[model samples]
Structure formats: C-alpha cells, structure tokens
Target: MSGGVIGTLGIVVLLVLLLARVPVAFAMFLVGFLGIWALNGWNAAMGLLGSETFTLASNPELVVIPLFILMGNVASASGMSRKLYDAAYAMIGQVRGGLASATVIGCGGFAALSGSSVASALTMGKVSLGEMDRFGYDDRLSTGVIAAGGTLGILIPPSTGFVIYAILTEQSIGRLFLAGVLPGLLLLAAFVLTITLLCWRRPELGPPGPSTTAAEKLRSILGAGPILVVVLVTIGGIYGGFFSPVEAAGVGAGMVVVYGFATGTLGLQAFWQASRESIVTTATVMLILIAAHVLNPFIALSQIPASVGAFLTALDLPPTATLLLILAVYMVLGCFLEGFAMLVLTLPIFFPVILQLGIDPIWFGVLVVLTLEMGLISPPVGLNVFIVKSVAPQVPLGRIFRGVLPFWFAMLVTLAILVAFPAISLILPTTMFG
Candidate 1:
C-alpha cells in the first residue's frame, strides 16, 4: 500500500483508539510508531523511537514545565489564589456584576501563575463560587463566569498551552508567551464586558456586591500585594531580557515557595502535596511531548500536510478563509477532544499548513490557543464545564453550559480581533525581541 494511504489509515485507527478510551499519549505513540514502521522499516522505527525519546527526555529547556507547574501548585495550596481573588474583588466588588468580573480578573491573575486551564478552573471555582453565591448572584452567571474565565489560564503567559505549542512548532517559547499577553488581556476584557452587558440586561442575574470601604480595599490589596509583585517581576523580567522563559519560571517558583513558607501557609504537608501534584502534572505533559515527537516523523512520511496544502492552494482560497476553515475544524473537534490532547493530535497536521501559508507562527499560536480556550468551555467536552459542575454539584450541568455561551461568544470576538490585527498578538514579542 502507498505510504499516504497507510498514513491515512493510521490516523483513522488513532481516532478510533482515542474514542475507545486509550490514553491520548499512548494512542499517538502507538499509531505513530506503527505507521513509521509501515512506511519505513522496523529498524528505522526503533531507531527513531529511541533517539526521539532520549532527546526529548534530556532537554534542559523542559525544566521550565515542572518549575512553572510547581509554582502554581504551591500557590494554590498556600491560599495565594484566594488572595488574588480578594484583591480583584475588593477593587470591583461594588460594580454591578462586579463579582463575575472579579472572578474573570482573578482567573487571569492566577493563570499568569499556573498555565493549566484545569488548575485555573478548579482553583477559581473553589475561591469565587461561594462568594458569588453569598452575594445572591445567579447560579448560571456564577458558575459560567468561573468556567469561562478559567480558560485564560492557557492563553496567559506561563501557559502550558503555549509551551506545548512552542515545542511542537520550534517557535521561541518566550515569543509565544509574549504573544499570548495582548490576546489574553483582550479575551479577559471581552469576558468582563460580557458580564457587564449581561447584568445590564438583567440586573437580577448579578446583583451588586457589597461596597467595600477604602480601608477594606487597602487591606485586601496589602494582603495580596506580595504574590502579585512576584508574578509581575517574573513575567516582566522575561520581557525585559533579564531572563529566559526557563529562568523566569525558576525565579517565579522559588519566590512562591518562599512566600508560602514565610506566611506559614505552606506547611510541610502542604509542600509535599504540592510537590506530588506538580510531578504528576509534569509527567503527563512530558509523555504527551514525547508522543508528539514520535508522531511527527510519521506524519512527515505521509505527506498528508502537503496534500492538504496543495488542496488549499488549488482552491485558491484567501488565506483568511483558509485559516478560518481550519479553526472551525478545531471548534468541531473541541466538542469531543480534551484541549491538550487535541493540541498534540492536530498541530502535526495543521501547523505545517500554517507555515506553508506564510502565517506568523507566534501570532498563529495566540489565535490557536484562544480557540483551545473555547474548547475548555464548549459543550459536550467542555472541560471547564465539568470542572465547575464538580465544584457546584447542586448546579445543573446544563446551567453551567448555558452560562458559558456568552463568554464563548466573547471568545469569538477576541479571536476575530486578533486575526484582523495580527499585531495585537505580535506587538509585544516583536517590540521586545524582534
């Protein structure tokens, strides 16, 4: 059989295996290894696997993953996340729908610390839901805001989404992290606007939170200031050429650990718990990366991306049209696949097409990450939706899904803005380093 035909069949079988509940990394590894064997030979496949595994496993750059993850976990266990939410809430609590807006801001802040959307959703849900509930905020708005806002975790810097995208495309992780800044901020603003409009339309949906006195606001700010300072210094240092992304991660992790201990929030037990969780999360990411490396060579042997590129080129569609079509496919797939799993499975096919079209990789990374953010709140497999449901068992899953709709629309708006003006995603990266 022709290599292309075999490659196509391999992908089909991979999908079947994934749907049948095979682990994502394992499914990719299996299909990729076998496809390489089929297309080349047993000796080549074994050699490819060994070299790919060793190279990926030994890369010093990957240390950033565990450090950033540990920073986030330590922050969460130490109640630093709550302080962030408190700071945002104190600043905006009196505004109508302010609680929801605060939740989004809090999510954005924590996202800067933790790049995992699941972690963001889980942490913010615990921190913000009870407060919103106490304020008599509508269930839909409360749960929905947390679920949707939590998506910023993957779009903001320190984002695992961007990190994985960078490794896959061989783009600069620093540039990708910087590229995420504007788009992430834009999406966060869009969500806040969504909440404002929703509350404006139906005041009862989100009643105004209790007005905070100046003293209370000052106190909350003082309470959270140190951790916020740590976050800003870490990210700012990266942007200012004082550190590489990996170095920034290490600085951030060390500062957070020190803060946790100094404040007595991170006891021995808490520290151990954070370390264990970080290890598990880091291991999961490494396995996916290793699997991606294994699958990449098989895809290249297939020429599937070339075929798709030619098809797109033959149709002579505008670049924007082609890009939109590809993203639409991501949206459809989002209904079924986990975000990171989807990223590993699809970038091999789609990223090559992106480069073939002369698209800027960093800008495309921001746009693609935003779409992945949508998946976190999209139906069926809306990972954040399930996360919110877990946090608020009394709320119907449907209600949480309903709550995410406006924010999903807000995401679409953010995506359109970024696409229309690529500079929105690239300006910071280009200005600082380009």
Candidate 2:
C-alpha cells in the first residue's frame, strides 16, 4: 500500500474506534503509532518514543496547566462558588427571569475562578441548579441555564482552553486571557438578555424570583467580596502587566487558600481532598496532551495541511467568505466531535490558512473559543448537556436540547457581534497589554 493510503486508513480507523467509545488520546496514539510502523517499520516507531515523552514533559509552558487546574480545585473545595452565586443572585435575582440571569452571572464568576468548562458546569449544576429549581423555574430552563452558563468557563480569564490554544499557536498567554475578557462579558450579557426576552414572552418559563431586601443584598455582597478581590488581583495583575500568567495563578491560588482557611469553610480534610484531586485531574490532562504532542508533528509531517490549504485557496474566495465557510464547517463538526479534539486536530490545517490570510491570531483565537463554546450545547455530543442530564435525570435529554435552542441562537448573535467588531475581543488586550 502507498504511504498516503496507509495514513488515510489510519485516520479512518481512529474515527471508528472513537465512535466505539475509545478514549480520544488513546485513539489518536494508536493510529499515529501504527501508521508510522506501517509506513516504515517497528524500529523507527521505537526510536521516536524516548524523545517524544521527554520533549512533552520538559515544556515550561505546560507547567501552567497544573497550577491553573490546582487553583480551580482549591477554589471549588473552599466554597468560593457558593459565595459567588449568592452575590450574583442578590444583585440580579429581582429582574424578570432573575434566577436564570443570576445563573449566567454566577457561572461567569465561577468560570473566572476555575478556568474549566466541565468543572464550572458541575459546580454550578450542584449549587445554582437547586436554587433555580426551588424558585419555581421550569426544570428545562433551570438545568439548561446551568448547562449554557457553564460554557463560560473557557470564555472567562485563566481558561485551560486558552492556555492550550496559546501553547499550540505560540501566542502570548497573558494577551489571549486579556483578549477574552470583553468577549466573555458580552456573551454573559447576551445570555441574560435572551433569557429575559424569552421569559417575558412566556412567564411560566421562569417566574419572577423573590426580591432580596437591600440589606440582605448588601450582606450577600460582603460574602462575595473575597472573590471580587481575587478576580481583580489575578486578572487585574495580568492585565496591568504586574505579573505573568504563572504569577497570577500563584496569587489566585494563594488568595483562595487563605480565604478558605480564614473563613473555616475548607478545613484540613477539604484541603487534602482538593490537593489529591488536582494531582489526578492534572495528570490525566497532561498525559493526553503529551500523546497529542507526539502525534501532532507526525500529522503535520504528512503534509495534509498543505493539501487542505491548497484546496481552500483554489476556491478563490474572499478571506472573510473563507472564514465564514470554515465557521459553518466547525459548527457541523461540533455536533459530533469533542471540542478539544476538534480544535487540536483542525487548527494545524486551518490556522495556517488564517495566518496566510493576514488575520490577527489573538482575535482569531477568541473567535475559535466562542465557536467551541457552542459545542458544549450543540446536539449529539454536547458535554454540558450530558452533565445536566446526569444531575437531573428526570429532565429528559430532549427537553434540555429544546431548552438550549434559544441559547444556541444567542450564541450565533454573539458570534456575529464578535465578527463584525473585532475590537470587542482585541480592545482590552491591546489597551491593557500592548
């Protein structure tokens, strides 16, 4: 068989395995390893292993992954999320669809602390889901809001996805984090507006939540004050150029720990549990990433990207048109593929085309993240939807999908705003960091 045929077959086999419930990293690794062996021989594959493992582990940029993950675990264990949700609810739960709106606000705030999409979903699902349920909101709207709001995890600052994107593309992590801020808030606002408009039309969807007295509201703010301070210290320090992303992670983790101890919310057992969980989770992610590192350059060496790029250029389309076409393709792909795998696999091909078209990579990264955020709620393989379903099995999966339909439209609107106004992403990064 020809080398090209072997390579293509390898990818086909990997997809088949993935559909059969194989793990993503394992699927990629099996295809890549055997493809190399089939094309050359076993000795060549053996020779590649030592260098691949060392190079992936030795990467200094990768160190930030565990630190950020640790910070999230610590913050969650310390009860920071409850305080954040209380504060957000107090401030906004009086508005129409108030509980749902507060769900979005709380998710955004928790996303800032955690920087993980799944973690944010799980945390908010446990806390805000119950509150919304108790407030007489529709089960669909309550769980759906938690599911949709959880996507903010990657949009907010200190995101793991952004860190991975920066590492893949060699962009500045600090700048990418800064660039995401405005776009994140814009998304949160769009979500709230969509909820308000919908519930206004159908009052049963989210009946008005009980109003908090001014004194209670003010008191709730005090509970959340530490988180706000941590946000300013971590994000503010990075944007103000006072600290690197790594340094910001340190400060954020330290502050959260201090808050936990001082408030006695997180005792010795909680601290130990958080530490242990952080190690396990970080290790799992790093292992998958290392496998990808071994696999990525081999895919690049196959010259598939060059072939794909040539085909895209041959279409003779305007740059904007090409991008729109690509976005549509990503949306279709998101229905079936995990967002992380899709991003990692396709960027090697598409990112080159984007750079060739003279687009700013930072602006494009934010756009890509927002697009991936949709995958968290899209049909067939929406991880966030599954998370909500797991929590509230009584709510049929069909209802959750139906519930997110309006939200999916809201995402498209948000994407349009980002596309039409690039500065919605770039303005903060350029002004603060440049």
Candidate 3:
C-alpha cells in the first residue's frame, strides 16, 4: 500500500487505541513509531525516536511549562487562590448571581496563575461551591459556573494551550499569549452576563449574596495582592519586552515560592507536595508534546495533510465558510476527545489548510482554544464538568451538565464575536509586537 494509505490505517489504529482507553501519549507514540517503521525501516524509526526525544526534552522554551505549573501549584498551596476568590466575593457578592459572578472572576484570576483548566475548576469549586450553596444558589448554576469559568485557565496569559499551539505551529509564544488576552476577558464578560440574565429570569437560580463593608472589600483586595503582583509582573514583563516567556515564568515561580515561605502559608511539606504535583503535571504535558513530534513526522510522511489540503481547495468554498467548517469539526470532535489530544491529533491535518487559506495563526489559535474550552464544559467528555463533579459529589452529574448548557451557549456567542471580528484576537499582539 502507498504511504498515504498506511498513514490512514495508522490513524485508525491510533483512534482504536484511544477508544480502548490507552494513554494519549502512548497511543500516539505507538502509532507513530510503528507507522514510521512500516513506511521506512526500523533503523529510521529508532533514529527519529532518539533525536526527537532529545530535541524536545532539551528545548529551553519548554522550561516555561514546569515553571508556570510550579507557580500555580505553589500558589494553590499558599492560599493565594482563596484570597483571589475572597476579593472577588467581597466586591461582587451582593449583586444578583453575585456569588457565581465572583466565582467566574475568581476563576479568571486563578487561570492567570494556573494555566490549567482542571486546576482552575477544581480549586474554584472547592473555594466557592459551599459559599454558593450556603447562599441557597442552585447547584446547577453554581457547578456550571465553576466548570465553564475554569476554561479561562487555557485562554488567559500563561496558558499551556497557547504554549502547545505556538510550538506546533512555530508561532511566537508571546504573540499567542497576547492574542488570548482580549478573547479571554470577552468570554469572562459573557459568562457574567449569562449569570445576570439567568438570575434576572428566575430570581432564584443565583440569589444575591450578602453585602460586604468597604473595609472588608479593601482587606480582601489587599489579601490578594501577592497573586495580583505576580500575575502583573510576569505577564506585563512579557508585554513590555522585559522578559521572554520562559524568563517570566521563572520569575513568577520564584516570586510565588518566596511569598509562600515568607507568609508561613507554604511549609516544607506543603512545598514538597506542590513541587511533586507540578512535576507530575509537567511530565504529562511533556510526554504529549514529545509524542506529537513523533506523530507529526509520521503523518507528514503519509502525505495526509497534502491530500486533505488538496481536497479542501477543490471544494472552492469561501475562506470564511471553510474556517467555519473546520471549527464545526473541532466542536464535534470536542465531544469525544480531550482538548489537547484533539489538538495534537488534528493540527497536522488542519493547520496547513489554515495557512493556505490565509487565516492568521494567532487568531486561529485563540478560536481553537476557545472551542476547546467549550468542549471542556460540553457533554459526554466534558472534562471540567467531571472535575467539578468530583469536588461536589452530592450534585448529580446530569445537573452539572445541564448547568453548563447556558454557559456553553455563552461561549458560543463569544466565539462568534471573536470570529466576526478577528481584531479582537489580533489587536494586542499586533500593537505590542509592532
């Protein structure tokens, strides 16, 4: 059989492995290694395995992954995340649906620190769920907000999603980080609006939380100062050209560690635990990235991207229509695949099409990440939904899914707005880099 045919079969086998519950890295690695061996020789496969492993393992840019993750883990262990939530709660908790809105704001703040949607959802769920429950907020709305809001972790600055996309597409990580800022804030605003409308309609879904005194609000804001400073210094340093992404990450991580130690919030045991967790999370991301490099070459050898690109060209659709079609496919796939897995599996096939169509890679990255966020709260494989469920075991899974539906639609609206105006994603990157 031809290489293309063999590549097709390899993809089928990879999907089968994924369906069989194999780990994503292992499945991709298995398919990629075997496919290269089939198309070339065992010697070629082994050479690539050795080279690619070393190249990715030694990449300096990848250091950002562990540092940012360590920053997040240490921040969580140090109670900074709780302080962020408290500040948001003190500021907005008196409005209708205020607690949920606070949760969304808190999630956004934590996302800037964490860059992991699961961590954002899990932390925010633990911090805000009980407070909302005490305020007599419906579990559906409360759970939904946590799951949906947590998605900001991937869209805000310091996002691992952007890091992976940048590496895969060979784009500037700083540009992608800048590109995500406006869209992330837009989605946050959309979630808040959704909460407001829901409370406006039902008046019971999320009742108004108790008002806080101005002094309490000031105290809470002061409490969040450490995290706020870290976020600003790191992200702002990147924007100001004072630091590369990796430098920013290192600085952020160091600052968080120092703050943790000084405040006595992060003991030696807690620090060790946080470091261990960061290492594990970093390992998982690194493995996926390494596997992607292997799989990319196998797919390239198969010429599937060329074939798919030719097919798409033949359709003669307008560029906007074509973009929409690709996004539609991503949305469908989101139901079945974890966001990053779907990203790695599909980008080799789709990214070339995007470039050929003259679409902006940075803008497309924002769109793709937003769609992935939708999937996190989407049904079936709704990963963030499941994360929230694990935190609030008493709440039915179905209710959590139902709760996310409105926020899902809200995200859909945000996606549409971003698509309609590419400038939303492009402006910051362009202005800053230019």
For residues 339-427, could you state the per-residue lDDT of candidate 2 as single tens digits? 77777677877889999988889998998998899999999989999998988888999999888888888999999899889998998
Best by lDDT: 3
lDDT of 1 by residue, 142-178 (tens): 9999999899999998999999998888889999988
Model 3, span 1-434: residue lDDT tens = 99999999999998888767799999999999999999999999999999999998998999999999999999999999999999999999999999999999999999999999999999999999999999999999999999999999999989999999988889999999989988999999999999999999999899899999999999999999989999999989998999999999999999999999999999999999999999999999999999999999999999999999999999999999999999999999898888888889999999999999999999999999999999898889899999999999999999999999999999999999999999999998898899
Over 4 Å off, model 1: none
Ranking 1 against 2 by TM-score, winner:
1
TM-score of each: 0.98, 0.96, 0.99
Model 2 misplaced stretches (Cα beyond 4 Å): 1-3, 40-43
lDDT for every model?
0.91, 0.84, 0.95
Evaluate residue 23 in candidate 1 and report its C-alpha lDDT on the 0 to 100 scale: 86
Arrange candidates, best lDDT first.
Answer: 3, 1, 2
Q: What value of lDDT does candidate 3 attain over all alpha carbons?
A: 0.95
Which ten-residue region of model 1 has the weakest summed lDDT? 337-346
Off by over 4 Å in 3: none
Best by the TM-score measure: 3
